[model samples]
Target chain A: MRSSVIIFPGSNCDRDMDVALKKFGFKNQMVWHNDQSIPKSDLIVLPGGFSYGDYLRCGSIASKSKIIKSVIDFANSGGLVLGICNGFQILTETGLLNGILQQNKFLNFICSNVYVKVKDKQNKYFKDLKKDLLELHIAHNEGNYFCSDDELKSLEDNSQIAVTYCGVDGTENEKTNPNGAIKNIAGIFNKNKNILGMMPHPERMIDKYLSGEDGSLFFKNILDNFK
Target chain B: MKIKVIVTLKNGVLDPQGKAIQQTLNGMNFGNVEDVRQGKYFEIEVKEKDEKKAKSLVDDMCKKLLANLVIEDYKIV
Candidate 1:
């Protein structure tokens, strides 16, 4: 599979995402944010980092970058687009995904491993996946997701909710919620499910020695789905 | 014209920074301190000569970029 990771001015995870995609047998290319067009690829990724120094708002400036139009066009056409952490913020800013990520409830940057429950597996991202619960790493200050009540209802009705924060034994409640996101939502999908935006970093967990192999399952699963 | 705009979190949206500031003020002996809600202000210098035109342009800016309508409201003053 071929993947393109867009690198904004302050994007720090583009290389890591490239490495992870390459490790999982994907031909990955790093695309600059100012570029007008992206190379042909099966997947497009907006990696995590404080884009434009998280200026006015997280991902707000980066969402208006030159290449974002192409990204939006790709997603509108049912192409696979994935945004992780700050990338997720950009997705919402671009209106490709629902809701906005607010500051953490305690106003602190949280960097730790979190368990996320797969909410819906009918999409291409998680279809036929072996595990229902996956341990992933989440690191961000504005990861608290919020949306209007009407929007939330539509998401729930359409199974647009992709994953949510949970406990090791699959218990989900206030105690397990790290950033006070609405409904402990860690990730969500567009109505078409072609676009996915989440606050977790799967690239950071691709290695078992350094982190864990659950991220491997994630990457390998996508490659499998692509095939 | 210099159009002044204020962007604030909509009612019912949690403002952690504002809450912290409120608590800090209370701890510093301001016992009657009420709730605090943080907001952003911007002064936009528009080339448009008409006041209404300038404000309308700024309103577009607020909707497009300044404030996220999902949780914030932008007011032109």
Candidate 2:
């Protein structure tokens, strides 16, 4: 499989995502944010980092970058696009995903390992995965997720919610809510499930020695599902 | 013509920064502060001679790029 990782200015995690994708047997290419076209690939990633210095709201400016038009077109045609951390913020800003990732409710940046419960396995991103709960790394100040009540209802009704923050034992509640995301939503899928936007950084957790191996499972699952 | 605009979080949206500022003021003995909400202001200079046209262009800017309609409201002044 092949993948492309879009690199925006200040995208600190672009190389990490490229590494993770390659480690999972994907031939990966790095695409610059200024490029108007992407090489044909099975997956495209918007990696984590403070794009455009998080100016005019996190991911807001980068969402309007030249490359974003192509990205939006790719997603609208059912292409698989994954937005992690700042990438998730960009996806919401682009109107490809529901809701906005507001600043942390407590007004602080949070960097820690978090347990995320896979809410649905019907999508290619998490389908047929063995683990129900994955340990992932989350680092961000604007990770709190908020949406209109009506949109939330539609998401729940359609099972568009992909993963949610949860306890290690898979229990979800206020204590498990790290950044005050609504309903503990750590990630979500578009109505078609081809696009996923989430706050956690699976690329940071791909190695057991450095962190943990659950992220390995995440990457492998997508590759397997594609095949 | 210069167009002025303010973007604010809609009612019921959480404003953590505003809350923090309010708390700090209260701690400084400004107990009369009932509530506080943070917002952004922008001034755009448009070349149009007509005030209505300048304001209209700014209104489009607010809707398209200056504010996210989902979480913020923008007013042109």
Candidate 3:
């Protein structure tokens, strides 16, 4: 499979995504944010980092970058696009996903490993995955996801919610919520389920020694589904 | 002409920074403070000389880039 990881200015996790994608048998390419076009690929990733110094709201500026037009067009065509961490913020800013990621309810940057329950497996991203919950790393200040009540209802009704913060036992509640995101939403899919925007960094957890292997399962699962 | 605008989180949206500030103020003995909310202000110098045109341009900017309508409201001041 082929993948592309867009590198915005100050995108710290782009290389990590590149590594993760390649390690999982994907031929990956790094695309720059200023480029007007992207190479054809099966998957495109907006990786984590403080894009545009998180100015004017996190991911707000990067969402308007020259390359994002092509990204939006690719998404509109039903291509798979994944946004992780700061990338998730950019996706929401671009209107590709619902809601905005506001500052944490406690007013602090949170960096930790949290359990995320796969809310929907009908999509390519998490389909056929063995585990119902996965341990992933989340590092961000603005990870509290909020949306209008009507939008939330529509998402729930459509099974657009992809993941929710939870415990190892798959219990989702306030204690497992890291940033106070609405309904403990850690990630969501567009109505079509081709686009995924989530706060956790699966790329950061792909290694068994460094972090854990659940992220390995995530990457491998997507590649398998594509094949 | 310069267009001045204020962008604030929509009513009922949680504002953690504002809450922190409110708590700090209360700790400083500003006891009557019931609540606080944070917002952003922007001043844009538009090329249009007409006040109406300048305001309209800024309004578009707010909608497209300056403010996210999902969680924020922008007002021309």
Candidate 4:
């Protein structure tokens, strides 16, 4: 399979995503934010980092970058696009996903391993995954997810909610809500399920010795589904 | 003409920075402080001499870039 990881000015995780994608048998290319066109690929990633110094708002500036137009077009065409961490923030800013990732409710940057329950497996991102919950790494200050009540209702009704924060036993509650995301939403899919935006960094957790293997499961599942 | 604008989080939206400032003020014994909210202020000097046109341009800027309509409200002052 082929993949492309878009690199914004300050994207710190693009290399890690490239490594992870290649490790999972994907031929991954790094695409710069200023480029007008992206190489044809099966998947495109907006990796984690403080793009544009998190200016104006996290991911707000990067969302308007030159390359984003192509990214949005790709998504509109039903191509698979994944946004991780700062990438997730950019997706929301671009209106590709619902809601805004506000600052954490506690007014602090949180960096830790979090358990995320896969809310639905109907999408290509998580379909056929063996586990209902995966432990992933979250590092951000603005990870609090907020949306209008009506939007939330629609998302729930459509099963657009892809993953939510939860405990290891798959229990979801306040204790597991690290950043005060609404309803513990850790990630979500667009109505078509071709686009996914999430706060966790699966690229950061692809190695068992360095971190954990849940990310490996995530990458492997996507490649298998594509094949 | 110079256009001035203020952008603030909409009512009912959580403002953690504002909350922290409120707590800090309370700790400093400013007990009368009911609540606090943070916002952004921008002043743009447009070459257009017409006040109405300048204000309209700034309004457009706010709607498109300065403020995210989903979570923030912008007012041309």
Candidate 5:
């Protein structure tokens, strides 16, 4: 599958996503944020990192990038988009996603391996991946996912809530959730269910037996979805 | 000609930065800290001399990129 990853000035995870896409057998290209056109691609991935030094707000400045307008158009045209970490914040800022990345309620930046509970396995991004426990690293200060009550209710009702933080036994606790994100959310899908934004760095854990390669399934899921 | 645009979060949207600023003011014993909502000041110097056209263009810029209509508002002065 063809994919493009957007690289903003301060995006540190662009290469990590490039490496992950290479593993997925995709002809991946890195698009600069200032470019007004998006490469013709099946999937667009917005990598993580402190875009524009996370200044003003995490994704505020990056969302105004010229390429982001095309990304928004791509989403409107039904193309798949995935935003990780700062990428997630950009999606919200651009109105592609339905929430904002508020300051972590704990008033601290969290950087560690976190355990996530998969809520859906039917989506293209989660195919071959069972609704099971996943260990991934999350690093960000503005990782808090905030939405209006009505929007959250709609997402929950539509089964768009994709991933949540929880213990190994399946119970969600505030402590293990790390950022005190509402409903322990680590990720979510857009209204069309094609776009996804998550805080955990799946690209950071793609090697099995080492990080158990849990992140590999995410790419595999996308590659095999072309059918 | 110069026009200033101030953009701020709309009511009910949480402004943590504004809250922090307000807290600092309260700590400083500023009795007149009625409210504090953080906003951006965009100092625009447009070559257009028509006041009507300048106001309209500035408003368009604010709508398109300066402010997020969903959760924020902007004023041109």
Candidate 6:
């Protein structure tokens, strides 16, 4: 499948994403953030990193980059966009996705692999995967996601709440909730429901036994519906 | 005229950095801290002397790039 990843000046995960995509058997193009166009692809990923040195706020400045206009247009056209870590923040800042990403409630940088339970499998991204539980690595200092009460209710009511932080035993992990998200949400999808933005790095856990390959299926689920 | 631009998080918005600083200061025994919120400042010296035009430029800069406007609010003083 054709794939592309956007790279901003401070993006440190660009290479990691490229390697992950390659390991997934897809050779993808790395699109620069300044380009005012989205390269044709089945998937577009905004990888994790401190874009624009996290100036002003996490993912705030990068949202106004030249290429964001195109990304917004792309998402409006029903295109698939996945924002990981800072990418998730950027998406929110750009208003391509709902809510705002604030700093972790703990006032510290969390670098541990996090467990995420799939809250919704009715969508193509996780349609085949059982909605029981899954695991992915989350590395971020500003991963706390917040939205207005009404908007939070709408997100839940529509099953757009894709993933939440949970212990390996299938219970919510309060300490690891990190940012005290409204409902331990680690990832979410837009109203259009096609675009997804998540803080956990599925790309970091796609290898079998190594990362248990639990996250690889997330990609396969996408490939299944796309190609 | 020199104008000070103050950018701050909106009400009810979480400010982790601000909270951290507040705790640090309080821990050092600095009392009388009511509330704390983080903000940014931009001291711009502009060539345009017309208040209307300078104000318009600053607004445009904030709207087009300087500010996210989604979660941040900025004012020129």
How does chain B score by TM in each prediction? Answer: 0.97, 0.98, 0.97, 0.98, 0.88, 0.86
Write candidate 5's Cα lDDT for A59-120 as tens digits.
88898888988998899998999999999999988878887887786667899888899887
Ranking of candidates on DockQ, top first? 1, 3, 2, 4, 6, 5
Tens-digit lDDT track for model 5 on B1-77?
89999888888877777877888899999968977888888899888999889888889988766776656788886
Winner by lDDT: 1
Q: What is the DockQ of candidate 1?
A: 0.97
The candidates' DockQ values read 0.97, 0.90, 0.95, 0.89, 0.24, 0.54
Which 10-residue window of candidate 1 chain B scores lowest in summed lDDT?
B52-61
How does residue A44 of candidate 6 score in lDDT? 84
Candidate 6 or 2, higher DockQ: 2
TM-scores for the candidates: 0.99, 0.99, 0.99, 0.99, 0.84, 0.91
Tens digits of per-residue lDDT, candidate 1, B15-74, equal 999999999999999989999999999999999899988998998999999999999999
Those runs of model 6 whose alpha carbons end farther than 4 Å from true positions after fitting are: B63-70
How high is the DockQ of candidate 6? 0.54
Q: Tens-digit lDDT track for model 6 on B1-77? A: 45558888888887777888888888888877757899989887777879888888888877755665656788987
After superposing candidate 3 on the true structure, give the runs of residues whose Cα lies further than 4 Å from its correct spot: none
Weakest ten-residue segment in model 5 chain A by summed lDDT: A122-131
Q: How far is candidate 2 from the true structure (C-alpha RMSD, Å)?
A: 0.7
> lDDT at B14 for candidate 3?
88
- A84-136 in candidate 6: lDDT tens per residue? 99899989888888897777888778888778888887776887774477778
Clashing pairs in 4: none
lDDT of 1 at A44: 97
Judged by lDDT against the true structure, how good is candidate 6? 0.82
- Name the docking class for model 4: high
